[model samples]
Target: MGNEKETPEERRERMRQRELSNPSSSGHGSNLSDLVGGLGWKGTGLLILLIITGFVVYSLATGN
Candidate 1:
């Protein structure tokens, strides 16, 4: 009986308050960690592509 339904706005506000109360729990860390942690398949593919491109460029520069 004590538990009442919360409206959408109320629920959103409650969640916002909870997030504000615990800043660390928000999952935002250092910029580098955030960038690395947020990487997905696309980022991984791009990293691979960059590595291959770098190898090719290095070999070309070395005439190898």
Candidate 2:
């Protein structure tokens, strides 16, 4: 029944409350947003892209 439309700020507050209320949340430190500056899964993809591009550029520059 708590499916009412919540603004982004409200949604974040609700989630923050839930995490604070749950003791087990402590073990999982630094959720995805905090770890990636709020980039979440997109950050993972971007990081992979950067690594691959770097390797390609390095090989081409060194003629290897």
Candidate 3:
């Protein structure tokens, strides 16, 4: 009994209290990891494209 896990409702309430205490970090936009988690394969491709574009731009700018 002492080592029992918290119920879902209790966990949610705890999260709500935490968010109420620290508003910024708990907001929807602040949940960057969760937001990015749903990007899946498309997000990965976009990230790769951006990285490649940045590298190309940097190389051209530096004449390297």
How large is the C-alpha RMSD of every model relative to the true structure?
7.7, 7.4, 5.4
- TM-score per candidate, in order? 0.42, 0.40, 0.42
Model 1 lDDT, residue 33, Cα: 51
Runs of candidate 2 exceeding 4 Å displacement: 1-39
Model 2 agreement with the true structure over 1-64: per-residue lDDT tens digits = 5657778899899888998899586797677667677776788789879989999999999999
Off by over 4 Å in 3: 4-32
- The lDDT for every candidate, in the order shown, is 0.80, 0.83, 0.79
Residue-wise C-alpha lDDT for candidate 1, range 1-64, written one tens digit per residue: 4227887888889889997798788677556555656897689678779989999999999999
Point out the worst 10-residue segment of candidate 1 by lDDT: 28-37
In lDDT terms, how accurate is model 2? 0.83
Greater-lDDT candidate between 2 and 3: 2
> What is the Cα-based lDDT of residue 63 in candidate 3?
100
The TM-score measured for candidate 1 stands at 0.42
Between which residue pairs do clashes occur in model 3? Answer: none
How does residue 54 of candidate 1 score in lDDT?
100
> Number of the top candidate by lDDT?
2
